[model samples]
Target: MLRVFRHYIPGITFVVIALDVSIVSATASLAGALGSWPGGGALWPKAACLVAVVLLCLYLADLYRLERHGRRELSARLLSALLSAAVITAAIGYAVPAFRFGRLAFGQTFLLLTVALGAWRSVWVTLDPGQRLRKRVLVLGVGPDAAQIVALRATGAQPYDVLGFLDDAPEAPERVPNGCELLGKSRDLLSLVDELRPDLVLVALADMRRSFP
Candidate 1:
């Protein structure tokens, strides 16, 4: 997780966005390489513009916040975003001749973006599951409250994962009813956060402390 302006954004969010940009650029580059196209490396700027527009459309469609939405909603919204991108891209190509990917090549780029991006996201969903949407959580203590928290983290119902617990003692209890690993000590919160990078750090101890990490 990365803290930006006091807000915690999932680390995977940046990774996926980077991948999306790369995917978009690659598709654009491939289309730019078509025999009928003129410039060789001059395609980068146009590709960058396309990438920006596509990302903007996806963001506006709420694709980045997938945890709160379902698969069906995902597909529908994506289709809407892509269609919007295509229309905007076509308009830009018309108004700016220099950035225009010839009609044939533009069609190819659009097709590739749709298929490649759709396939990549599907793979992300299968491989990474809720990493994009769910928060990677690190609980501060292994107490009754933590155990109840573990209970409440229902499968497929919540948007958080209890990455495990941190305790004041070095050793964990014999039976951690929370069913999560004892990662480290409470004093090691900062170090553990740097190591695990959980999106949220929850203090689950029954006791209250004046200073908590």
Candidate 2:
């Protein structure tokens, strides 16, 4: 981990930051090419400004930190960061026309940035070959109570990341699950909590009969 301004961050994090910079810059260029940026000097300076401001907003939102986050949770944070960037960038451009890239251009760039970043993150979360990118979760039970969670996760609408299910009587057919992989019996609860330090342990068992571990 590298210490960035007293904040310890993994070296790989910088690569993501660099990618974000490129995305923002490209968005600005695309906007300018659309003839929306009028009377502009070279657009690079203006693009750089956008990149810096947006990056700062992302930093403030702690987006650079690698953590377990579901799509909805991650999207909320991204939306907040972009909103802050929009405000700060608009103010900077307004106070100094020299940095202004025109209203239409800025709007178009901002919109593009939003769409691009959102799409980028969707792929980022999905392409987790290591299965460690998303938030880690353990479902305590796989009964009727846990059905909603399973369904939500299946549709990728759940805010909290649910890795799998835990049942005392683990079945062979995915362990009485709705597309949720059965991790293990609840008896080994202590050992099962080893991976990625699960962010949440949800006890959603419909029936806690004698089989409860």
TM-score of 1: 0.63
Please give me the total number of clashing residue pairs in predicted model 2.
0
Query: What C-alpha lDDT values do all the predictions have?
Result: 0.75, 0.73
Q: Could you give candidate 1's per-residue lDDT for residues 128-179 as a string of tens digits?
A: 6656577778888776676677777756575677877777643456535645
Q: Write one digit per residue (lDDT tens) for candidate 2, span 1-213.
A: 354553334467789898999999889889878888533576777888889999998888877654655678778889999989988888887887767778888789889988998888778878863344444568887776666776565356444566667776545334455555566677756665763256788886657676566
Candidate 2 vs. true structure, TM-score: 0.59
lDDT for 106 in candidate 1 is 80
Give the runs in model 2 whose Cα sits over 4 Å from its true position.
3-7, 129-213
